[model samples]
Target: MASEPGFLPRDGLDRLIEVLRRDGREVIGPRVRDGAIVYAPIATAADLPTGVRDAQSPGAYALNAASSAERQFAWANGPQALKPLVFSPRERLWTSWHAPANGLHFGAAAHTTRPTAVIGVRACDLAALDLQDRHFLREPYADPAYRARRESLFLVAVHCTHPADTCFCVSTGDGPEAAKGFDLALHEIDAGFVVTSGSNAGAEVLASLPLAVPAEAQRDEARAGVAAAAAAQTRRLPARDLRPALLARIEDPHWQVVAERCLSCGNCTAVCPTCFCNAEIEEPVSDGSVSEHFRQWDSCFTAGHSRLHGIVVRADTLARYRQWLIHKLATWHDQYGRSGCVGCGRCIAWCPVGIDLTAEVAVLCDDGEGVAP
Candidate 1:
C-alpha cells in the first residue's frame, strides 16, 4: 500500500541531493550568508547551513551560530520565497528594435529557466504556492512564464518543528505541519529524518535512496516534535475570520495610527508570500536601436500604484495602508477565495516599524482575543 513513511540517515541527504541533480534539477536550500539565512544554489549537503539559528522579531532579524549541531533547517523562512523563482520579481519580457530601413522590429525575448528541486520548504510557503498558482495559472490570462517555472518545480517541504516567533501559520491554517503541496515532506530528528512521499516523483527519489521504514516509536517522536513547535508559538491570528470585520472597518481610525509609523517602504508587500503585484517598464538602449521591456515588482504603498488619470486614488499613507491591509485580509478572499496572507510573518518581521498585522487588526476590530499558539 506504500502507507509507511521511510527514514533517511542524516548523512543520506547528500544522496538525495545527488538524485535530484541526476534528474537534471538544481538544488536550492537555505544557507548562511551576509549574516542571515537565505536561499542559494547548493550542490552537496555541506552547502546547507548547519549549526545555524536565527532570531526574528518585528522589524528585526539576526543570525547566529546554533548551539546545537542537530538544528540545520530549524530556522524560519528567509527573505526569499518561491515567488521570486516562479513569478519573478524582475525579468526581461521582450525587446523591440528600430531598423533604419524599416519601421520597427519586435523580438520576443527568449526566457531560459532551470528546473529546481527546492529543499527546506515549509508549510506556510506551500499554502502561498496554492495562492500563487491560482493567481498566475488558474486566471483567465495565465502567465506562461510563471506556469513554466511552477511546473518545473519539484517541491520538498520541511515540516517546521521549530517555528519562529514571527510565524502565525497555525492561525492561518497553513503550517507547523506540511500535509500537502509537496513532492516529499520531511521531519528532521536527532538520528535522521522521517520522510514521506506525496507524489510519484517523490516516490521515485525515495526508491533510489537508502532508506528504512520508520518504526512506530520514531514516527511518534517526529509527530511530537512538530506538536511541540506548534505549542511554542506565541503569536497567532484569531480564528474569528477577520475578513468580514476588516472589510467593514475600511475607514477605521486605526489605519491612521499604523500609517503614522509606516514608512511606506513596501517592505510588507515585498516580504509577503502572496503579494504578486508587478509593473512593466521599457528601457531604451544607449545606441538607440534596441528597447527592452521588463517586469519589476511594485507595491501598493507606492503613490503611483493607485494613479488614476493623473490623480492618485490613494493619495495619502492612510489610504494606502488601508488598501494594503484590507486587500490582504479581507478583499483577497473575495478575489481569490482565501486570505492573501499565509502567516509566514515575513511582513511583520521585515516591516521597518514592526507593525504587526494581528496587532493592527486587533486595534481596528477592538478584539484582544487571538488563537493561542
Candidate 2:
C-alpha cells in the first residue's frame, strides 16, 4: 500500500483497468452512448469517452468535442449514476406456489452479484451514494439485494474539473473534489492523473500500478482545475438548510406557478441520484398456481403513490410536486442528516420543459408579494 500520492501516466489507465479485471471485477466506466455519456462495461482505456465534453442546461443536454484528445473525464456526468448498479431498476423478491400436499410454499428469489469496479465516478455522485447507503444499508432493516451489490462495488472517483452550467455541487458541499468514500480517487491533468487511495483495497490497487510521485506542477494543476470548477458553477440553492423555509411555504402560490410548467412525468426523480422511492408488485400465472413478487423503482409524482384506501392523497399535480420538493430539500435533512439532493443538477437538465429546481426554490424562498397562505 502506498502512503504517498502517485502519478499514473495517461497510458497507464489501461493497466488500472486490467488490474481490476484480473481481480475478477467487472470494469464499468463512462462511455458515449445515444448522444450522451453513460456507464458501460470497459475493457481498456480506449473504451472511455475520450475528447468528449457535455453541455447541460435546464431541460437540455448535448455532447461536443473537446480540445484535448487525451481527456476522458472532461464531462460533468450522465443521467445515470451509481444508483442503478446497486438498487436495481427492478428485481424479483420472491416466488410463491400452491401445492396439493402443502397449502402454499414461498421461496426467495435467487440472485448472484459479480464484484464490479466503476471508474469515472464524480464527487457529487459519491455524495448521493452515501445517502443511498444510509437509506438501504441502515441497521435493524437492510435490503439484502442492495447490500450484496453495494458490498461488491469498488468505487473510483474522478474529481470534477469541468462542470456544467446547471451544476451546483459547491453550494451543497458535495463536490468539485472527492474527499472520501472511494477505493481510488483520480485527479486528471493534461499529461496524466494524480491518484490516491482512500481505502486499504484502493491502496493495494494503487501500489500495483507503475506510478511515479506526482510532480509539484501536476498537483498544482489538479488543485487549480477543481477550484475553477467550483467557481464556474452559476446555479445554486437559495440556502443550504431550506427545511424551515420550505415547510413554511407548503401552500405558497409558487407551487401553482411551478406546476404549470411541471408535467409530473417523474423525469427528475428518475435521474435524481438520491430519490429512493419504490413499489412492490406481484405477477401471477394464468392458472394462479404460482406468483412472483418484485420491487421496482417508484416515484412520488405518480398518482398511485399517494393512494390510501379508495382515495388518493395529493391528487393534483401541485400537491405531488410539493411533496417531492419538500421531501428532497427539507424533510430529507431530518431523515438523513443532510439534504437529499447532491446538487448534481440532473433534475434540471433532464426535465423536458426545463424546470430548474434551484430557480423554483429561489422563488419559493422569496418574501415577495403574491405569496399565498
Candidate 3:
C-alpha cells in the first residue's frame, strides 16, 4: 500500500477487538438483528452483518437478507444515530429546594458508558458529529455529558462502498465517504482494510494496531474507491443558496400542501443530527428538599415548542411545519454558518406520514398553488 495510512488484514480487526475487550471496553458495532443492522454489543468482528443489504421506506424498514453473502454495506442510515447515546433523551439539569439552605445544585452528569469502541460509523454520521460539536461543545453553555462521551469513546469510521436512494450527502456538502474526525477510517481493500488517521488520536490508535504502510499506488485506489461510493448515491437536493429561498417562501402555498400530510410528529427533527431542541420537565419532591428539572427531547411540531406567556406562536400546523423546514434549510445557515441537515435520510425513512423532504422541497421551490385545504 503506497499512500495507505495503514493496511490491516481482517485479523487486525480481531486484534483491535481483543485489545478493547481486554481493557474492559464495551465494543459496539453493526450486527444483524431481526433482519436489520443495528448497533449492539459485538463480541467479535465475525458477528457483524456481512454481505447483507438493508431496505428502508417511510415508516417502514426491512433488512434485506444476503443473497450470496457478498455484503458491501448496502444500507444508508440506521433507525438511531450516535446522538442519543451521547446526548441522552432525558437528563437531570439541576436540583432545587425552598428551605433554609435555599440554593440550586447543578446535576453532575457524565457519559460513564464504559470505555467503548464504536465501529462501522458512516461518513454522514461523522459529519453530523461535527455539527454537534459546534452546538453542544463549542457553545458557551457546553454540555459536560456530551463532552465526556466524545472524549472517552474511540471511533472507527467505515468508508461507504454503496449508497442508498434516500441519501443526499453530496448536496449537503458532506459525504458518502469518510473524511475526518475518526480514530480510524477504513476503506475495504480486497480482503483487508486501508486505514488512515483523521487526527493525532487516530494515529495513536494506528500505532497500537498491526498494520502495513501501503505503496503510493494503493493510496490512489483507496481514494478512487471513496469517490466511486459517493458517485453511487442517487439522491440529490439543489441547495445552492437554499437558505434565502426558504426565507423568501415563508408564506408559500407549498407549506399548506406539506402540512396536510405532515402529522406534526416531529420525526424529522428527532432524526436530524443537527436539530438540537429540548424541553425541561421538573419533578417536585414532597419534602421540599429537592426538585429535579429534566431536559428531554422536544420538537417544533408539538404545541409546547413555541409557547410564551401561555400564548403559542405558530399555533397552527401549517406555520409550525413552515418554521421547521425554513429553520432547517435556511435560517440555520444564518445562525450556525452551516446547514442543519446532513442529508442522512433518516427523517425520510422514519416519517410515519411518508413526508419525503426531497418531495416537499421540490414543491417549495415551485411557483404553483399547492393542494388546498
Candidate 4:
C-alpha cells in the first residue's frame, strides 16, 4: 500500500536538476526570455524565471521587474504551458506521390522517449493534466504519443507562493498547492524548498537524494506556505455545483456579451492546457515518395473546429462562445468527469476580448443569465 511520502529541505532544489541530468533526462523549465517567462530546455538552475513578475488582466499581460533584487521565481504563468513538446503546434501526417505502389503513409514517425523532466510545472498545468489524463489516457482510444510522453516524464510541481492578479485556480478548484500527481512537489522556502513525493515513483527519486528531515516547525511552515498562497489569490470564481447552473442556461444571452469583441484569434485555447482539439495535415518531407502527415493543435475559436460538412455546427460567434463556456464548465464533466476549466486564468489573460470565465460563471451562478451584459 503506497502512502503519502515527505522529504526534508535540502541545500537547494536547484541541485535536483543535476541529479536529473546525471540520469540523462533533458530538463525543460520556465526561463526569462525576451522580457517574458518561456519554457525551454535549460542546463542550469540560473535560467529559471527569477525575480520578474507578470501583470495580467483580462486581455492584457506585461512583464514587471523583479520586486526584490534576489527574486527569480516570482511571476505568474507565461503565455505558454508545456504542451508544444507533447502535442506539437504542427506535425505532418503522411505524404505520398503519384505512385500507386508507394504504400500508405503513417503520421508521427518513430521517436525515442527522451526521459524529459518538466521541472517547474505550475499547479494549474498539473490540474489540467488530471483532466487530460481522463480524455487522452483513460479513454477507449488512448493517444499513444500523449501516453508515452506522460508516462515517461517526471513532473515537478511548484506550489504558488505568490500569485498573479489574474490567477484564479482556486476559483476553478485546482491549485495554490499540488494536491496530487507529482514525482516531487516543491514549496519554495527562501533559499531551499519543501519537497514531498506524491507517488511511489516520487519516493524512489527522493530516496536517492542527500537531504535533511524538516523539524516539526518547518513542516508547519510548509503547510502555512501552501495556505498563504491560497489566501493570496485576489480573483476567485466561487461556483462548485456547476451541473445545475451551467447546463440549465445553455441558451442564455450572456454569450453574446463576450462574443461581440472576440477576435477568434485562438490565443485562449492555445494557452489553455486542457483545451485539446487538434487537426492534422499531410506534407512532403524530402521526397515525393515518402510524405508525412502531422497532427497540429486546433482551437474551438477557429471556424474549422466546428465544421461538419459544408456547414459549421456553431456558426455564429454567440453560439461558439456558448459552446466554449458550456464545454468548459458543464458538458466536460459528462465527457471527462471533471470541469474543463482548471482556473489557471491563462484564458482570461490571453482572451483578446478580456472575457473571463470566472466572471461569466459569477453571472450565471447569480443571475442565471451567464456572462453579464
Candidate 5:
C-alpha cells in the first residue's frame, strides 16, 4: 500500500540508504565530482552533494558551493541522466568463433544486472525513462538486455525546486514536480524531506524509516518552491507540439546559420537522455578465430551515420543538423506520439558552442505557421 505524505528528518536520510543497501540494492545518487555534479555509488547522506548548486547556461556548466548545509538536491540537473543506466553506452551483443572440426560456433553475450536504487532522480529523467521504455520495451521486439536492467531498478525521484535558465520542463509538462513513474518521490525542505510513496515497495521502505506527518507549513513550502521553480525558467519551446512547423521548415535558411556554429561533435545527442542512436561493431581476435559483436552509442551528427552504398546521404553539417532537429522535434511525434525532448536542457547546457534548441524553435516558428496554440 502507498503511504501518505510524511516527513523524514535530516538524519533519516542515512537510514534510508542503509535500508536500501540492506535490501541488496546498490544506491546511486548525485555527488560532487570532477568540478561537476555526477551520479555515483553513495553509501550515506553525507555522500550527497550537500550545499552545492549548479550554474548552467547555453554551452556552459559550473558547480558552486552554497552557504547552507541543509539542502542536498538544491541544483536542477547534471549532464548525465537515467539513460545510460538502463540503455548501456556500450555492451557486447554476441560472439562467434570458428573451429576446424565444428565449423562455426556462436554464443549470445551474457548481460549481468544488479538491483539498483537511485536517489535524487529528477522529474525530467523519469519522463525520459518512459520514452526509452517505449522504444526498447514496446511491441513484440523488446530488447532482452534493456529489459533485464530495467526490471532490476528502483526509482527515487526528487522534485525540482531550482531550475536553470535553460530548463523548460514546465512547458513540456514533465517537471518541477514529479507526477508519476517513481517508486518514491521527495521534496527537499530546509529541516528535512517531505517524502511520499508511489509503489508498494516504496511504502515498505517508508515503513522502515522513522517518519512523521509533514506539517502544513512544510507542505506549503514545497508547493511554493516548485511553483517558484516553474516561474524561474526563462526558456520554452514555441509550442508543445512542434511537428507541423518544424517539418515545414526543412528548407528554411536557419539551417545554414545553425550548421555554421554546430561542430557536428555529437555532444548534445550524447548528453540527451532520450536520444538512443547506436552502432553495432565487430571486434576480431588476433588469430581471426573469434569475433565479438558489440553495440555502442552513436549519434546522427557523425559523418558515417547516414552513409548508404558508399555514399554519404547527409554529406554536410547542414543536412546532419537538420536531420537531428527535425527528427527530435517533428518526426519523433509521428513515432512516439510526442516530442523527443524532455525539457531537461542538457543539450543546451552541454553544447560546446551554445546552441539553444528552444531559441531555434522560436525563430523557426516566428511566423506562427502551423504552430499549435
Candidate 6:
C-alpha cells in the first residue's frame, strides 16, 4: 500500500469495506434487490452483484445476469441516485408549539445522520451531486441537513466500463470516467481495479490497503476500457446545449404530442437525480397544541405544484409537460449555470410510458414553428 495511483486486487475490496466499517462509516453500494440493482447497506464485498448488468430503454428496464464471472460491476446505473441519501425525500423542517405565555414558538426539528461511505457511484450521479451542491450548499442560507450528511460522507466513484442502452453521460461530458469530486475512484479491469485517490481522506484509506502501483500496461488497458464504454453509448440529446432551442420552442406542438402519452405521473422527476423540487406539508397535533412541518419531494407534473390563488397555473397536461422540459433543459442553465440533467437516463428507464426526453427534444427542435390548431 502506498499513497499513489495503484492497483487494488479484486479480493482487496473486502479489505476496503472492512476498513470503512472499522472507521465507523456505514458502507453502501449496489446490490441485487427485488428486481434491480439498488444502493443498499453492504457489510462485505460479496454483497456486490456479480455477473449482473441491466438492459434499459424508454419506460423499460430489466436486469440480465451475465455469464462472465469476471465482471463484478457490469450494471451502469440504478433507478435511485445519490440524491435521496443526502437530500432526503421526506424530512421534518420545523415544529411549532403554542402556549399561554407565547402564542406560538417555532423551533428546528431534530435530525440524525451517520458517517457513510458510498461505493460504486457512477460519473453521471457525481455530476448530479455537483448540481445539488450548488442548490443546497452554495445558497445564502444553506440546507443544514444536506450539509451535515454530505460533510460526513465518503465517495467511492466507479468508472463506467459497461454503460446501458439509455446511457448518455458521454454526451453530457460527465462520465465513462470521473475527473474529480470523488475521494477515491476505481476502474475495473480483467485483473482487478485501478484505483486513485483525489483527497487526503481517500489517500489515507488507500494507504492502509494492500495495493500496488498499476503497471503502465495495466493503466493503458483501464483507459481503453473506459473509452470503449463511452463509444458504446447510442442515445443522447440531439444537441449538447438545448437551453436556447428549448426556450424558443416553449409553444411547440411537440409538447401536446408527448402530453397525450404522458400520465402526468411525475415518474421522471422522481427518478431524476438533479430535480430539487419539493412541497411542504403541515400537520397539526391531536390536541392542536403543536404543528409539524415537513418537506417532501414534489414534481412539476403535479397540478398542485403550479397552483396560485386557488388556480392551477399549468392546468393542462401539455402546459405541465412543457414546464418540466423547460425547467430541466432551458431555465436550469439560467439558475445553476449548468444543465440539470446529467444524462443518467433514469428518467427514461423508470418512466411508465417510456417517454424519452432526448426524443422529445429532437421533435421540438425539428420544427421550430409552432404547429397550428
Give all TM-scores, in the order shown.
0.95, 0.97, 0.88, 0.88, 0.97, 0.95
Candidate 6's residue-wise lDDT over 11-115, tens digit each? 899998988776689999999898989999998888999888799988889999765676778888888989999999999999999998869899997768889
Q: Can you write out model 3's per-residue Cα lDDT over 1-373, one digit (the tens) per residue?
A: 1123788776678787776564677888887776566788888778877777766655666677644364445456676677876777888766665656655555544445577788888888888888788888876888887888777778888887656656778777788787677777887755577888776656766777898877667677667867876776655667575787678787888788888888888888888877788998989888767788789999998999899899998798899988887888778777778777887888887788877777677677763222112
Off by over 4 Å in 4: 1-11, 93-108, 284-291, 367-373
Better-scoring candidate (lDDT), 3 or 5: 5
Q: What is the C-alpha lDDT of each candidate?
A: 0.85, 0.91, 0.75, 0.74, 0.90, 0.87
Ranking of candidates on lDDT, top first: 2, 5, 6, 1, 3, 4
lDDT, candidate 6, at 346: 90
How many angstroms is residue 86 displaced in model 2 relative to the true structure, after the best TM-score fit?
0.5
How do the residues 1-373 of candidate 2 rate in per-residue lDDT, one tens digit apiece?
3357899999999999998886589999999999999999998899899999999998899999976778999999999999999999999999999998978999998879999999999999999999999999999899899999999999999999999988988889999899888999999999989999989999889878999988899999999999999988878875458899999999899899999988999999999999999999999999999999999999999988888897989798999999999999899989999899888999999999999888888788883311112
Error of 3 at 99 (Å): 4.1
Per-residue lDDT of candidate 5, residues 1-373 (tens digit): 4568999998899999988886579999999999888889998899999999899998999988764667999998998999999999999999999999979999999989999999999999999999999999997999999999999888899999988878988878899899998999999889989999999889888989999999999999989889999988878776557888888888899989999999999999999999999999999999999999999999999978888899999999999999998999889988999999889999999999999888888888774422123
Candidate 2: stretches off by over 4 Å? 367-373
Strongest candidate by lDDT: 2
- The 10-residue segment of model 6 with minimum total lDDT is 364-373
Worst 10 residues of 4 by lDDT: 1-10
Off by over 4 Å in 5: 367-373
